[model samples]
Target: MARLDRGSVSGAACGPDMPAIEVRSLSFAYPGADAAVLEGLDWSVPQGAFELLVGGTGSGKSTLLSLLKPEIAPAGERTGDARVLGENVADMDVRASAERVGYVFQDPENQIVCETVWHEMAFGLENLGVSRDEMRRRVAETSYFFGLEDWLHRDTDTLSGGRKQLLSLAAVLALRPRVLLLDEPTSQLDPVAEKNFLHALFRVNRELGCTVVVATHQPRPMLEYATRAYRIEGGCICKVADIASLGHREELFSGEVSGWGASRRAKNGVFSSASGQLDSLGPRGGAPGAKKGLKSGKSAEFEVQILSQDDSGVPSRVGGGRILQKMHGGSATTLSEGWFRYDRAAGWVLRGLDVTFSAGAVHAIVGGNGCGKSTMLSVLAKTAKLQRGRMVRGAASAALLPQNPKALLVAETVRGELMEWASTCGYDEDAAQERAAQLGLDGLDARHPYDLSGGQRQLLALAKLLLIGPELLLLDEPTKGLDLANRRIIARALCEHAQAGGTVIMATHDLDFAEQVADDIAMMFDGEIACMEPPTDFFADNVFYRA
Candidate 1:
């Protein structure tokens, strides 16, 4: 067991007492890795304070979170001490540490272990050996707090990404841990749900007095609730000024909090930017107003161009191009009177939805969780069959990137993953490397896919998808866990793809990414397309949908 004996450091801002968590001279390196992930890091987290960890992909934020818990801490070479609640974390028993510190993983699907929401919430209590009556009371309270009552009896698999994540949080909180650690818990959620989840955390901290620490790439919304913020870079954690003191700095408000360019000293206070490299994309045009072209009041439409060129200088007769000519004379795909559901007993997920996706355009489907956005994308990609209605596909072939990036990763190494896709697509090794570089995945060739950060895994998946060169590209939550820099790179890549006469349909909760990249926006509601229009009109007309 390692312990640190150091005098209290100033500027803790937690409370005038021993910090909830303290680390001194901490350094760690994974087995077989060449360089240390964390180097001589010193950090203090105040009791009952909401702390946020911000960094680019692979900056060791998740690794730091893992070290906070003894039960699940990664196997690594380490030096120095980490204390949780005045006790050496390394010395604590796994079960005891777990009782005091609850961790929620980034992937909710991976974290959930029970069949139903009720069972999931009660699992932790059962492990702790709580009496049946006490377990029921705790589970009931947590489920209500998280608004899971309606679906408490539903199968875990039936819930949406957002709901599953909420369930995961509720399950952890059921244990009543004093310290809560979350690693990008909202990475799979939409903007509205993300805001809601953060608010819930704020309540947990304010009402329950639980110390909260979250690691996230998207930190703008959470910033207002954060008492302190830290940036991880160069294998160390540097404390930044509180979010309140930063004021209306556009960079801070713009969701680009992954360390502004380079670190610099501040004289009076901590200064940081919410802006990122992608800020240069400039402002978009258009105003909020009623749009034409929809008779069903349930759907909306936008005009987009399809650009195609080949050896014969004629559009290739495959994928979106082939489907375009037949559907709407030039559109990529059309869904008329579409109805779908996972199971007949589950009821309809998409109800009489009518929508047309333009060819050679970047189209985004925006909606709340479980609104059939993903289901519609699946139908377009030909992954899901339309239970009822007609889907006319102009595309001879298409590529779909599922919400879970790990599903697409089959190769041992990043380079091998891209090469495999290239080989299947009849492209050379150089082409794969070029595409990888386009997505900012240039130097990660030798790294294992699973070893990469969540954002990096997403980028690798995008690289593979792009290498296939499908006419129509379907992406689900493409920018979920990515930093602003990588988001900008992906936005640029998607725009270039559209310019080359390719089609892109992305179902995402990232309004910023959609605003920056999509030419048209479709808002899905209650298993139907509530409206579709230019980004400006769509956001303006719907007050709640605006980010």
Candidate 2:
């Protein structure tokens, strides 16, 4: 939260109809790059409009967002005129620009600097030299509006991922910036939390008149609230249109089908709600061998069944071999009455959790934030000791990828990092390169690992772990900042791993992804696993846990 010290530019008076942001013939490249990441890009955001920026991984969405602020503008050759609130961003003072243009990073932890929630909210105002009374008043108002009153006195480290992200937004909003720039703010949140956070952003735009520009891979949830939408490709703006004219609003809710007896049809592997009779006896319907009119015990609710077929109307086996082959005979890890906690004074994170992971299978753990999903993964990965439970390990070794992928990144270049892991695992350079290409890191071998985008960094970390050839792979939020295309790549890779007799256990808030790849879905709640069943049964039966 240290204030940047670049010199300031005098504020320019803007008319009511002027755009909040305007860019013309902007081109930028990093210090050592051969070509510009953004080339001849021109864009504008209408005043008070909620703008959504959608693009694939490494598509310059982040680069464009960075150029909007003076303090964080990338170091490189630049040619263009970028203006914010009628003032040229290149000439604006750091402090003044920050006051009118608030930026929130993808990772909430990165933006937070103070220990407690209250202090974090006050940090930005303090940097702006606001009076003590005024700071207190603004902090109180912002916190209350964001619903942080209950946790105001609590330590920030103790809050859940969702709360931490909300706290970051509240802190930025306390400055009362005229425009807010968010980079994948909801990528780490659960479905419910993500929805709530987007609604809060809508309120900020509608009620406070703060123009918003969000760059996200998951744009379906925010489309309804967006006034305009733009798609970036090949370092340029490819499509721009009003949100209402997008003609695919219903498709946005395709992945969120939760109510009992509710049936949904899958389109190109994405799920959406169905209002008519459920199809239970066809290739596009329920489980094979299931009755035509399957219903739940209490009511006529149809049993949740995911149709297994590719887009071409043909049965397709996603995994190499038979699905769920390991569930019958293979067991990688078993936790019996497992219980864990950080300290004796703190409440237990995992309470009597009993679950078994099968080899040659992908298991997904889904739950609300702070419900012990990560803690369970740590226990299974042997990073955390099981205090009061019997544990059985079936695998010889396991590789744990923490939620923050940056933790495992230390090498100067991406290739060096992978090669280091390869050397440890007795792998050759060819094998390393092959794996890197599979994960879409083919041409980034010589680039600095820190310089890659967040999604790229996540993929590199995964590639490093894959080179080790561990018996068990543990991933936490593998798809946090990845676009849909990148997510598909990871999903296919995990499926191939399972086919090769390896165990894969991932804890994610992405329920759509869980349905797409998981053989078994486990729900954790109140420090204990509440249920474990097939993807179809797990999502259809549980109302709240269904994403």
Candidate 3:
């Protein structure tokens, strides 16, 4: 159904007993931009609606959410009025609105302000002047609920990405806001951790009736729970009467609700199944085999290894455990070796390890929350040394795209930056520009690195590394903050690069993304590789193979 226009909505009139949030004709545009992000958008949530907003990236879902809490709205935008809890957002003060609205940013790093989990959780209550004793109680309560009591004192930097996101939530929940806005809160989490977080969210909604609104490209987890599902397009919102009727049942499991060949309506009498769509749900596809023969099972795989760079700058004397696996190609990759711990207090975090990645293939790693997937990726990237057994390999060129690519960008113009990296790679300016265009950065030569969105920044960072032509690329949770169009733009570029015979390794919670683009699949649990196989087999049956 098409959505209403902003001019059609009114602020002075919501019927009595209206939902916690009501938007009518809420239109807005970003600063210095003539185009409006939202036009004639209208949506309303009763006192306790669990609303789920689903759309591709840059579809104006985030922009709509920002309107609910005006403090976060971008500057230089004209907005039709939106009322939250009987108060017009434009008229309300920012701080007071913050206290009443709990918003969790998509990037945990952006929202995290404290050094430790305990302090971070308590910061909100402290600002509200909740007594010290009360703050302590709230902290303890939230920690216990989110399973963070043991790591309460742990440094925020030391926490894994999933854990860091969990901490972000606990901190926001500590504020006990009347309305909760989660912006892709589960993008970094593994399966288990995501389930736990959702359980907590539902509990809060059920018990406290804290009106919940979440914007996400992935909707399976919230399918049965969300009171209403709304789709955003052209900066407008429309009520979706029945999501099941959309004919994308697979979306209820994997988030591949949108994609090429994926959005095909149930037409032409074609039947679909797990392996791939078919005329009939039969075994003809045989669940496409993995690149490295890793099988599937319910439990995750775990392997471990440790090695050090010798005096000759070569990987020498691998001594950790059995985490190393040599694929058909010459390259060797690391899988988790059961959960490893540096101290007794840290306990075991990784479990069974099994992952098989071909040297020249594009593989994606994903799992539920707190599943030690990022830790394994860090090990692969050689960023976090393992105390038990770090996966060590012979000298191989590797480039990693951290969750935030902005951290690595340090150039004035895209052209200058690529030129700098080209010099390092012994390439000339013309060569660098050629590579930049291939990556889809046309006419962006003079653009400041900081001006790019998360996706564009990532592409630029990748361009810099590609100039050197690294043999292996390790991308840690690359699509966390990207919109669908941006995500597709990056994915297509990576696919082209892979076709050119480079090995691409991506760790993400986007399962559908893996299914669509990965040549091989790896699933991590605890600190081990649970399964590694082809996308088809991994999703249908979780299994990892050993070489």
Q: State, as a TM-score between 0 and 1, how close model 3 is to the true structure.
A: 0.72
| Superposed model 3: Cα runs more than 4 Å off | 1-16, 245-330, 333-357, 368-371, 386-396, 410-468, 482-491, 543-547
TM-score of each candidate structure, all chains considered together: 0.82, 0.82, 0.72
Task: Report lDDT (Cα) of residue 497, candidate 2.
Answer: 61
- By lDDT, the candidates rank as 2, 1, 3
For 1-547, candidate 1 gives per-residue lDDT tens digits of 0111123222222333768889898999876567888999999998889998988888899888889898778776989899877778887775667566889988786689989888999988888788999999988877777788898899988788778888889899888777899998887777778878888888888787788999988777787888888999989999876665433322322443322211111111111112222222112233222222212211011111121222233432432222111111245688999999999789799999999887767888888888888888889888899989999876667889888889899998888898885535665776667667667787778778877778888899988887666678899888877887787667666754664456789998887667656778888989999888877667677767664
Prediction RMSDs, each to the true structure: 10.9, 9.6, 11.9
Weakest ten-residue segment in model 2 by summed lDDT = 297-306
Residue 456 lDDT in model 3?
59
- Per-residue C-alpha lDDT of model 2 across residues 310-338, encoded as one tens digit per residue: 34434333222212112112556899999
Among these predictions, the greatest lDDT belongs to 2
| lDDT measured at residue 231 in model 1 versus the true structure, 0 to 100 | 91
